[model samples]
Target: MYEGAVQDLIDELGRLPGVGPKSAQRIAFHLLQAEPADAQRLADAITRVKATVRFCARCFNVSEAEECRICRDPRRDGRVLCVVEEARDVVAIERTREYRGRYHVLGGAISPIDGIGPDDLHVRDLVRRLDDEPVDELIIATNPNVEGEATASYLSRLFAPLGVRITRLASGLPVGGDLDYADEVTLGRAFAGRRDVRG
Candidate 1:
C-alpha cells in the first residue's frame, strides 16, 4: 500500500462506479503524471458539473435550469412522454431523431437483487406528472434486460388505470447481426415484434 495523498487519491478513485482497484491505481498514477493544467481542467469540470448540473423539476433530466431544454421547447409534443431509466437513456433517444416527444427520467430500474424498488425510483414523481400534465401516451423505453422488463411490467400495471395509453419499445436483433449469433430471447422478441411488409 502507498502512503499519504497517493493512497488517498487511489482510494477515492476506486469509489467511482465501474472503477476497480487496479483501474483506480492506474488513474491516480496517470493523474499524477499528467500536466498540472490538464489535471486542473478535469478537476474543474467535475466541480462545475456538481455545482451547476441539476435534475429538471419537470422531467428529472439533467439541466442547468429548472426545466431541461426539451421540457422548455415549444415544438415538442406535450401529449407523449417517453419514460427511461436514466438521463443517459434520454440522450440516446435524442440521438435517434425520430422521437419528437418529451421524456420522464425514472432514475433507475426496479432491481430486487440490488434492493431497489418502485419507492426507490422517481415513480411517485412520474405519477404526479401524469396527473398534472396532458401526457396522453407513455412510451416505456427501458432497457430490454431482465431488470428492465420487470420495471416495465410494473409500470405497465401501475399506469394502466391512469387513462394514458401505454406502449413498450420493440426489442429485436441488430440490423446486420446474423441469425446464428442471436440468442433465444432476442430471436423470440424479434419474431414477436415483426410486422408485415407493405409492398
Candidate 2:
C-alpha cells in the first residue's frame, strides 16, 4: 500500500482492461520516473482522444467527424455491408484489402453472461440502415467464438424477413498451420469450408 497520489495512480492504471496489479504498479512507477514532457504528452494524448474522437454517426466507428472516411468514400460498394462486433474489427477487415464494401459496427456481440443483448448494441440502427439504404447483402464478420456465433445466429434470424443476402465469415485453420496442432472445431470448419480445386 503506497501513500498519496502514487497509490491513486496504481489503482487507476489497474482499472484498465488486461492490466493486473503488478502491471499497474510497474506502469505507475514508470510514469513517475518518465521525463515530465513525455508523461505530459501521454496525458495530453488521452485527453485529446476523449475530446476529439467520437463514434461515426453512420457506422459507429471511431472518427473525428460525424461519419467515418469509409462511410463518406464514394468508391466503396453501398449495396454490400459488413457487420462487425466493434470498431477495432473494422480496422482488422480494412487491413485485409479483400473486402471493398462499407461496414456497420454492432458495438458488441450478444453475450448473455455479460447481460448484453441485441437491444444493448446498435442493431436497431443496422435494421434502420437496411431499410433506408440500398443494401442487398450483409457480411457477418463477428469473431469466431461462442458469443459471436450466438450473435450471428440471432442476426441471421432477425434479418431473414428482410430478404437480404446474409453471410457469415468462414472460420478455419490458418495457412501453414499443422493439422495435428489444430483443434477439432477448427479442423471441422476447414473441412466444411473446403472447395474443390479448379483445374
- What are the models' TM-scores? 0.95, 0.97
| lDDT digits (tens) for residues 51-96 of candidate 1 | 9999999899999999999999999999999999999999999998
TM-score between model 1 and native: 0.95
lDDT per residue (tens digit) for residues 68-175 in model 2: 999999999999999999999999999999999999999999999999999999999999999999999999998899999999999999999999999999888888
Best by TM-score: 2
Clashes of each: 0, 0
RMSD of each: 1.3, 1.0
Off by over 4 Å in 2: none
Residue 146 miss distance in model 1 (angstroms): 1.7
